[model samples]
Target: MAIDVRIPTILRSYTGGSKAVSGTGDTLADLLTNLDGAHPGLRGRLVTPEGGLHRFVNIYVNDEDVRFLGSLEAKLNDGDTVTILPAVAGGALGFAAAHALRG
Candidate 1:
């Protein structure tokens, strides 16, 4: 199965400056493995040593957030488009917490 992956700016160096890449994998985990094989150090950036997704990173398969869909185990079919978007919070979480405390 062929999967499309989006490369965030922070990790584009591993992709030869490309913002996107494509490869084949039967599962999301396998896809990530293939990415690591191709890019060398990409897997370290995406998956933790314990094989868990990084806290600040989010992955989407066909526009569905994998966190709600079995995380790294989320299945993908041929032609699936996976997007890797890292979370960016600028006091957003703190603001929300403070607002909740005031209520």
Candidate 2:
């Protein structure tokens, strides 16, 4: 089944700057495998060496967080849109806000 994968800007390098790509897999894990085949190094960024989702990466299938669904084993169907986003936080603005709050 063909699945649509939305690529985050930080990981666009792996997709040759494409914001989105397509692949085939029955499960999320299988989709990653297929995507990595077309775009080498992509899977490594999403999946840890121990075969689990990376701590800072968040995946959503059909607008639902995969963590609550079954993680890598989450079943996928045709035409599902998968969005991959890196958990973003901890910038200078946050630090400054914390300092202001303390004062």
Q: How large is the C-alpha RMSD of every model relative to the true structure? A: 3.5, 5.0
lDDT of 1 by residue, 15-93 (tens): 9999999977877888999998889898888899999998788899987998988888988899999999888755746
**What TM-score does prediction 1 earn?**
0.84
Clashes per prediction?
0, 0
lDDT score, candidate 1:
0.87
Q: Model 1: clashing residue pairs?
A: none
Q: Cα lDDT of model 2 overall?
A: 0.95
Model 1 CA lDDT for position 71:
84
True lDDT of residue 9, candidate 2: 98
Checking candidate 2 for backbone clashes, the offending pairs are: none
Model 1 error, position 79 (Å): 0.5
* The best candidate in terms of TM-score: 2
